[model samples]
Target: MIKAVHGDITKLQGVSYICNAANGIGPMGGGVAAAIRKAGGKEIETEAIKVCKEQNPMPGDLYVTHAGTLPFQGIIHLVTMKQPAGPTSYDVVRTCLHNLVAYCRKQGIDKVALPALGTGVGNLDKAKVAAIFKEVLEPVKDIEFIVADIDQDFIALFA
Candidate 1:
């Protein structure tokens, strides 16, 4: 059931869970995080920040929290901003996604969604982003990987 798809994650229906391209601050903003917050509500952000702050996972770390206004059971927040080297996050994109996926898999989560990290705030290449994901996830068997690209051209490029 783990596969890639092109769709609007905010409007995603009948799904049990999705991942947010959350910043280290753990607040909601534009792009996938914004859409999830807009769909789910502020409760999601509140719960996520609380959980993340409590556990205090280092950069390249990931945590989970209630979806609140979002449609899934929970949201997986990955700390792509605080990676070991620095905030210059281009190198962390794949590691972050891989860690995000691994964190989900460890929890017995088989179905989930994700957005292209590093592309928005991180300013990375589109092809490389897609390739990194494909490389990291192609070997996994159970986790359903859905990529949400709200733009048609963006979706086509990934397609």
Candidate 2:
């Protein structure tokens, strides 16, 4: 089941993990990433950077790290752009969603919360990206997704 919720992603309950639309090199400088870093803790960013150092992630890759001070099992970083503040296309967003599903299935993760991919610094259309999320995730089985946003308008499209 995929549900849309209006609020801060960090405040979501009953979810063991949340998704972060991140860049190839992890910084968590602005937008949703920054919010997660602030609420969760700076160590979240440090852990992501440590993972990047091992193998710099490209778009469509999924990396998991400790949730720091957040109340979750882990944070799933979905690489949406090659660099911080770089542009991302609908194709890349689609690819990331597909990869996320694959990773979740492979790892047996059942529930996750995610924000609108590529709509912030990546500048992709929110509605379009939301549609892509529905297109990819609606068909998957045994997974629960919460598409969270601060904007009510963005969350409404998921209705």
Q: Give each model's whole-structure lDDT.
A: 0.69, 0.90
Compared to the true structure, candidate 1 yields what TM-score?
Answer: 0.84
Which candidate ranks first by TM-score, i.e. highest?
A: 2
TM-score of each: 0.84, 0.97
Tally clashing residue pairs in candidate 1.
4
How far off is residue 29 in model 1, in Å?
A: 2.4
Residue 44, model 1, lDDT: 83
Question: Which pairs of residues clash in candidate 2, taking residues 3 or more apart in a chain or in different chains?
Answer: none
Residue pairs in clash, model 1: 2-144, 40-69, 40-70, 41-69
- Give the per-residue lDDT digits (tens) of candidate 1, residues 46-107: 88677767777665677777887555788777666643223535557777777867777677
